[model samples]
Target: MKNNNSICFISFFFLFMFMLMNMVFMLYFLMNNMILVLEWEIISFNSMNIVFSILIDWMSLVFMMFVSLISSSVIFYSKSYMSSELNLNRFIMLVLLFVFSMMLLIISPNIISIFLGWDGLGLVSYCLVIYYQNIKSYNAGMLTVMSNRIGDVMLLMVIAWTMNYGSWNYVFYTELMKDDFSMEVISGLIILGAMTKSAQIPFSSWLPAAMAAPTPVSALVHSSTLVTAGVYLLIRFNNLLMSTDFILLLLLISGLTMFMAGISANYEYDLKKIIALSTLSQLGLMMSILSMGFKDLAFFHLLTHAMFKALLFMCAGMIIHMMNDNQDIRYMGGMSLYIPVTSLCMNISNLALCGIPFLAGFYSSDLILEMVSMSNMNMLIFFLYYFSTGLTMFYTMRMLMYLMVNEFNLMSVYCLYDEDFVMLKSMIMLLLMSVVSGSFLIWMIFSYPYMIYLPLNLKLMVIYVVIMGGLLGYLMSMMNLYSVNKFIMTYKLSNYLWLMWFMPSLSTYGLNYKFLNLGQNLMKNIDLGWSEFYSGQGMFFILKKYSIIFNIFQMNNFKIYLYSFVLWMLFLVMFMLMMI
Candidate 1:
């Protein structure tokens, strides 16, 4: 009864958000029509061009559709997924907030608007992750907050640099044409920010750790917005991205990241973490496509990846929830026979993930591989893509075989009804799309006789490679060679392989330690040549750090407000004085 009530409440909230989005879209359209109907001679073509440029268009609409689609499915999926949990109203509210922020992120006209939405989404995601208030959820939520802040800081720096050089346009490509600046520096900073958001190398561990959140969080984060923020940034600023030699950076780093993450996924015992790592690896593949000068292909991959990965996570959720919250695959064998629908859907999606032709992953991944093939084929990129494809199959089969095929000692037994109808329905939707649209979309995106750009008939060659790779991995699983490919086994000698080494993870503890140490050791003495701001002794340190503090007119409980007021006053005073 409570479950039914909760669903009704959340469904209402979902309706509210949808109505609001439609209202915004309608208002925008109305305003556009009004302007057109007025026949205003005052509206110059150049002025209209500027206004229209700021409006969200087809590309933004594409992302917006993804946001709405994934969010609605999650809302329905959550009816059963969270049915037994408490604080249900708050969860529903947060879901609304999550959807709102994602929609805002795409439609944002300026960098400021984008970051506002970005931080809002990040904040809501943190709350959702920690909603259960368990230790793992709390820790994971805190880490997400900190890592997202790091990305935010880099973005602020980009904004500052662009404002200085290109007049605060905030239209992404405006800065690309600025010849006075070093393209390398700007592109480097932008890519650095993208890497953090996308969970690229050295930063990849945070994503898998994020599995401590609910399965729905994992689904959305991996599929649509949070991780894709970086890719979206790169795509939006394609001109700037194209300016840097960073294409190689994206290629080599993304390929290596994919290989490393794929290897680590094999070691993951948690079902969600396994898929989480696969998410990271798959994003790396998309990034590899982005780096290969195939922006549209990358976006197509992003679209399909969102569908299939969300399906995988939702299925994983149903399985875990049914097994009474036991997520370890080792403990999950012989259950596939028990949950036929889940097993079938999961198998098909996992096969799609392994790039089985006629499935979603096959077409998009083939485009990426073909791009990699034509571009000065680095043997390493070639081998890594192939090897990752093989491993994708191996681990996916490992998951299927362990859950459905093998006989293992039961860890804990419980009888679960087939996943709720709503959850099952969503999974079915994803499954059908993953299977049918893969080929159709591929043909739509690329020319039919891809033979002109691709030797050996690109589509056929891709199908062949995928089959070969999946078969190799499947055979390897049968032979039990999967253990050797796991990252923990590969990295045993590193000794420092604990999850804390992840930059996002380390940044959490590292900030506390760094600030604490800095607070303890003040600069007492300095060479005169190195310090023009210094007075004798340590007086300079006080002045340097507290200059803004000295000018404050108010001291109160609200530190932030007081600081903002004082800063505003200072700006006002300066302006008035300058006018005189």
Candidate 2:
């Protein structure tokens, strides 16, 4: 127990110190407009050079600061959250390793170094996901690792392709190779890799499945390390991905991902899964705007989202802990009555997620929306943008309703309180950031404010959508058991929405069954039947027949030996005559 406490304390101290140092450097670089690159050549083969490179600039520093802050808070929170667990030290180490990998990824401009960090993030996250020893954790770990392996392979291809440019450092070649076919392939592959990492559309199931990990892991993964790695990579590669067709495709895919996640969150009942889906929805928002060339806006939102999302997860963790590990929203209600402080934190984070006025999410999300409206995009994209925004509010309101307004459905004897000061302290720190980080970031990141010339109705559209979505969510939450169940009447539609449009099924059973069945048939017919008979069992039979014939010769050993001696002497005499 003392050992675990010491490890957590030491980690928190060092991470917090680093966060402070990075923030100072971020401000200094931002003010000076300075970028420092430190490089050391590892090997030179012909024209290709592999160098270990680190980029120190405002962007990297700011991101590192935020990552360190969140990591420190998560570590401190885990001091209480995982207190009773036997392997708290191991958990802390895994989290630290995750942080280290993220840092490596943030500072590298070289694709080779980026891949080192990228692969490290994937490997460490798999360990963290399956930290708990259980079948569900094991399965989730497999899904997470396998999904990320696609990205890893894509990055390896990128490394191979980038060799044509005579260096592994893509930062120098992005503009140079902009019009080249190799650049196009690299851009496409990078986008695919980012898609899997960020849990966009087809690769999204693993995000929710990953909730089987410990809550601290969830907070860190959803916020900074695993998922955001993709967005950060795209931010770095934004220069090369400016092709028209690529942007259009990314816009379509990311928009669909946003819509799918928002709708899925509304239908979800698990507390953690709802938050995880919200993370997915927000990631989609970031990717979509990034595709439209608003990389700065995307990055701004990424940092702010990290703040509140981490706070949100911490609050959720406290609630789940108090609820005796029950994750179902149906079993939780009136939590605000007991754990008011935690509830306040949850509400603040939830509102920030909804992009309520003056919060962390509002700054970036509102700007992204307004920018989309200003663009000459088609009606489909416009509809997806507004409708998805409303869905965000819709699900947020619905979740808050169940958590704060509905009757408490747990056992009567339970005691729930915000007595854990360690957890509360961390939540409070993030809560303050959630409230002010948006405005703070706006001033820091943008040199000039955006000018809007929208008419009245167009400007009010966001407000109208928010109100309508909230009202609908409230009405849905008010439905009684005696009332007609609309979901029961429309089973297929409800199930489709509930199951994330059958994406998880498509990713798992839909994709696996045919291949699994083929393997089974091959094992039975080829491996077990034909190959076994021709190789192992058939060879055994032939060897046994030969052995029996040899045994028969050995049975009459004395007579056979005498005949062999006479034959040998006659053969020797014949050989000698021939030689003469």
Candidate 3:
């Protein structure tokens, strides 16, 4: 809560403080972090018992705590960001509903309960995405909603499949179904669903396009709630997936997704889009690790990434607000010299993102890297992880150079100040957590350290990649190696990566255009053209002709009656003559 916006800020802060306390209670409960399931029959009809259930353990508890924290922080930040807006209450309600759905998803082990939350998330996100009511928002909202609907359908399929096992609660049967052949089919569908929700590979266009939503929505969607839901689902079902070929497919798809996002981010200019891409990359990172059989590691990173990434989005929002809503980094420069506090927050979050020594991102990402280094992986997996890691640094550096080091590029007033205390007050808490959560989690989560042994150069491979990526990014941004004309020489290649391999266009317009054209042809040639005549107009004419023929054939006239009486009398006379 702040001095001016007591109602809005207090509501956010209360939930935040409540979750902070929940974290402490969770810590105390970790002494026996056992799985506990609570269920209640909600309705009974036609011999089917519909139930709602909650899964309580370290995973759900910690995830709920983080979701709560992020949602609260986003709402608090929105208080300042949306101060002049008239429909502020509506925005806050949507955010609360989003958090509630995410919580339902996090806690529910029952398939039906999970689906309820999953569908709620997709529907509410669609509303939030189209909140601006602009053409771009509408288009993006459609893309996002449709993309997620695929996952919803997949979940429904899984729910139906689960019926064969006699219950909607999947946790009860994940281990039992491990060796069952049907498990492969169920898990594959689940992976597909998760991939769509998490923005993996072919389903990735929506995440970046979803930047049409407000920045606070981005903070919640990208960081703690929406995207992570997919990875978390995978983590929960990871045991079932481990024995299936889908697990390897998940791993390969995830690695490529990470690499793809990282490359696209380096070529992007929009600030929120770049952050969204980073989010995509991190999600891929979580999925890859989870697929590789390190679920606890994946989960740890998921939590830590949520803290700093949310902070990073908040910082981006602050910058975009100050710079008259121009999110292009090319139009921003020398910001650190102007608004020092925000710049500091941005730098810290960026550093954390790059896997700096002891910040939040380092703990789990470092462990995952070291674990990957120690594992027996193919060249492709190894290359993808390290390459993705380095590109992360590359884009972060490039963005920093354009925003903070280059000369002032803004066309607005010269005065630069950080008087948005409400925003800063919300961001500073995350700033502290981003610095501390990694180390704290390390101590709390790991009872014993992992035994990672490697050769000297191999151990330092990540550092080398980070250094090379940084140097390359610096050269690309700071040096005059290519003029506009020179850069345009490779326009096709540049645009390919810059446009995320043209995924948005291909996924949105290419698919939609083809289907739409097909529908139009069918409507003209079949529905309204020949088929209409044959089915409707042609059949009407046939019925009309039959009715006229029946009317003429009718025996209602006097001539027809007299002819019938004469025939009957003639037959009787002929019979009497034959007898005589």
Candidate 4:
């Protein structure tokens, strides 16, 4: 017990120190508007250079500060939450490692250190995800690792392509790439890397599937550090991404991802999975705004979302623990009456998630919507952005109603007591920050206020979406979509949307089916059918026959056996001599 307390305190103390330093760095950069770059040549040969470096600017400092703050809180929370586990120290160590990896990712400016951080995150995350040592955890870990490996391979490709610039320090060459025609392939590869990390479009299934991890890991990873890493990478590379047709492609992919995730969240039943889908949706929103050349806006939203989503996940974790590890909202109701504090925090996070007025989520999400509304985008992108926004609110309301308003459906009253102060303590900090982060980030990032002029109805478009989505969500949740006749009638359409257009299956089973079939064919025609016959069966048969023919002359007695062996040796020698 004492040792666990020490681990918790030591981890929190170090994180707090890093957080304070990040604040100082943020202040210094704000005052002077200077970027601090530290570099040393680590390897140089044959005109190739790989530099180890750190970039200390407003972006890195601010992001690192958030990472530290959240990690500190999560470590403190885990001391209580994971107290009974036999491997509590191991869990804390893994959490600390995850935080360190994220810091490495944030401060890295050169491709070498970036890849270092990148691979470290992938490896540590796989370990953390599979920490429970269950089948679900194992499968989730595999999906997470394999999905991220694509990004790692893409980063290697980018590293090779950067050889053209003579250095792997992209911080210096971003401007060059922006205007050079030669940098197109590099740009595409960078986008691919970003997509794989951010879980955009076809790469998104792993985000929701990662819910098999422990809730503290979910709060720390999906909510803040890991999922945002890709978006942050894009922000760093925003200089290179501007004015490219690839931006338009990003707009399309991100918008579709938002729509897809939002719709899927309404149909999702798992408590953590719903929130997981919401994270995917928010990631899409950030990517969409970034694609529109609003890098600061995306970063601001990323930070704010991280705050509330982490809090939200922490609260969900408390509930899941109270509910005996059942994550289905369908089995929960009237929890608000029993756990008022958690319910309040959960609802606040959900409302903020829904973009309610004056909350932390509002400051960034509202601006992004207005700016997107004013931009001269095509109808398709425009529709996707706003419609997905409505879908987001729709799912939020449905989840809220089911969780708080319906009858208490838990199987046992003993399942919950609603008095975990340790868990509540961690959530309270993020709760406060989630309420404050959006406005704080805006003031920090935006030096000049934008003059967003719009007509009355257009300005209130967000409100309209929220209102309509709430009403429809209430009715939709109340209606019996699972009734026998209704389900049969809407089977195909409901199933399609509910399963996220079958993307999980596409990502896992669909591709595996093809590969397995190919392997089966090879086993039949090549291995067992032909190669085995020629290499093993045929050779064994011939050798056995020759051995049998020779065995006919063997003797059972020891002297006879020795004499026969000697005679055979002499006969073979004489035959060789004659042939010669």
Enumerate residue pairs that collide in model 3: none
TM-score (C-alpha) between model 4 and the true structure: 0.88
Identify the candidate with maximal lDDT.
Answer: 2
In the order shown, the candidates' Cα RMSDs to the true structure are: 12.4, 5.4, 5.6, 5.8
User: lDDT per residue, candidate 2, 1-580, as tens digits?
Assistant: 9999999999999999999999999999999999999998889999866678999999999999999999999999999999999999989998999999999999998898899899999999899888888999988888888789889999999999997987887877789888888877999999999999999878988999999899999999999889999999999999999863677788899999999999989889999999999999999999999999999999999999999999999999999999999999998999888899999999999999888999999998888888888899999899888999999989999999999999999888887765599999988999999999999999999998799778888888888898899998888777786543766887889889989989888877765445567889999999999888789888899899999979979798787888889999999999999999
* lDDT string, candidate 4, 32-66, tens digits: 99889997778999986656788889888988899
How would you encode candidate 3's per-residue C-alpha lDDT over 1-580 as one tens digit per residue? Answer: 2433666776697778869876976786687766778888889999988788888887788888888887888888999898877778888888888988998899898988899899999999999999999999999999999889889999999998988899988998899998787798899999999999999988999999999999999999999888988898998898899999989988999999999999999889999999999999999999999999999999999999999999999999998988888999988998888778989999999999999898998888888999999999999999999999999999999999999999888785655666598899889989998999999888877877788999999899988998998888887788574555677898899899988888889888887557668989999999988878788887798889999867865947777678879999999999999999
Q: After superposing candidate 1, which stretches have Cα over 4 Å from the reference?
A: 1-54, 165-167, 172-178, 411-413, 439-580
What are the TM-scores, per candidate, against the unseen true structure?
Answer: 0.77, 0.90, 0.89, 0.88
Q: Return whichever of 1 and 3 wins on lDDT.
A: 3
Q: Give the range where candidate 2 is weakest over 10 consecutive residues by summed lDDT.
A: 507-516
Error of 1 at 120 (Å): 1.8
Candidate 2 Cα lDDT to native: 0.91
| Predicted structure 3: clash tally | 0
- Each candidate's lDDT (Cα)? 0.71, 0.91, 0.89, 0.87
Tens digit of per-residue lDDT, candidate 1, span 1-580: 5766666456746654664575466446534542211111334585342222233554565566556667767777777677776666667668778877777667655676667777887798788778777998888777777667777888788777766654444555555454645566667777888887898876675687678877876787789878988888787767667766877877888888888777666556788988987888888888877877777788878878888898899999988887778888777776676788888888888888888767888778876777666777767888887777766766776677667777744554557575578788768867887787567556644543554276666436555655665565455445555645563465854334334134454555676347545655544233433343455645777776687565553354478787888999999999999999
The order by descending TM-score is 2, 3, 4, 1
State the TM-score for model 3.
Answer: 0.89
What is the clash count of model 1? 0
